[model samples]
Target: MEFRGRQTQKCPRCGGKALINQYKCPDCGLIFAKLDMATNKAASQRYKNREKSAIVFVKKVPIDLKRWKLILYTVLFGLFGAQYFYTKRWWWGLCYILGFTLLSVCVIFNAPLLNIWDGGLISFFGLIVGVYGVCWMFDIFKVCLGKFKIPVSLPKNELNAVILSKEED
Candidate 1:
């Protein structure tokens, strides 16, 4: 009956196939008329070539109360750590030293996939919950030890100013 091939021709005026090979409506004299893809595979293939997708990357994620507390403590400890290193305070560095010491000890002392739990996720939650519990107790101890000094002498408003001063130092 007829021949079919790749999209090889285009119209000059509208740049569409209507004026090139196919019949344009005699009454309208239109150059670009849409065709049903069900009968014309070549036309549908042209659209498929233009389709594309895009992706994006994000940095932060939502964390729970315990994780939030850990994040806060870690930030505070890290700031103290830097301060201690600068001011030559051995006591402030004790936690970082002890933490690394225990980590090295753990690496040196492995028991081939150690299993202390009774085959459940309890062991996973246990560490996080345990750390949170310890932090709670530590908070209580600090509250008992002294009038809950707000981490530093500078007020919330003065933190930026204090930071600027430290930057000058």
Candidate 2:
């Protein structure tokens, strides 16, 4: 795509029109780069293809600025919410007390009415069922937000190479 503003600054590499966002130049040839979103690593994170957290990723083109920020913020919020629900076990512990007490009372009062009155069995059941329900809900919320974060970093070598390849994406 055409870059904005005047054709003042020349590519540090090619010394051509310098119209590109990045470029590279050698005595042999010149290259220029176009910022495209598909090539961006941040945008790719929406797919979680990253093998490591420290690995760098970039988008060829920056996306809608405000929208990208919102997606990132929302994903962070979702992560924290999921962590709180899954880990901070204070609330869940209380539920354990209430559930066991209720089950014990039902068994004691009605004898044969509740077949699963064994204490170990009932607590195991509550823990698994409760964890499953919460995890399921948290996953659903995160999946609904969709794509986000087209982050790009200008690498020195690639930026220089762009001067020679200065074609639009």
Give the best candidate by TM-score: 2
Count backbone clashes in candidate 1: 0
lDDT of 1 at 14: 32
Each model's number of backbone clashes?
0, 22
State the displacement of the C-alpha of residue 71, model 1, in Å, after optimal TM-score superposition: 17
Please give, for residues 45-147, the per-residue lDDT of candidate 2 as tens digits: 4235433322222212244334344344334533233322222222433554454455455446543433546456555655655664464355445334432
lDDT of 1: 0.32
The TM-score between candidate 1 and the true structure equals 0.22
Q: Lowest-lDDT window of 10 residues in candidate 2?
A: 52-61
Candidate 1, residue 131: lDDT: 60
The global C-alpha lDDT for each of the candidates, from Candidate 1 onward, is 0.32, 0.38
Who wins the lDDT comparison?
A: 2
| Candidate 2 RMSD to the correct structure | 15.2
lDDT of 2 at 42: 36
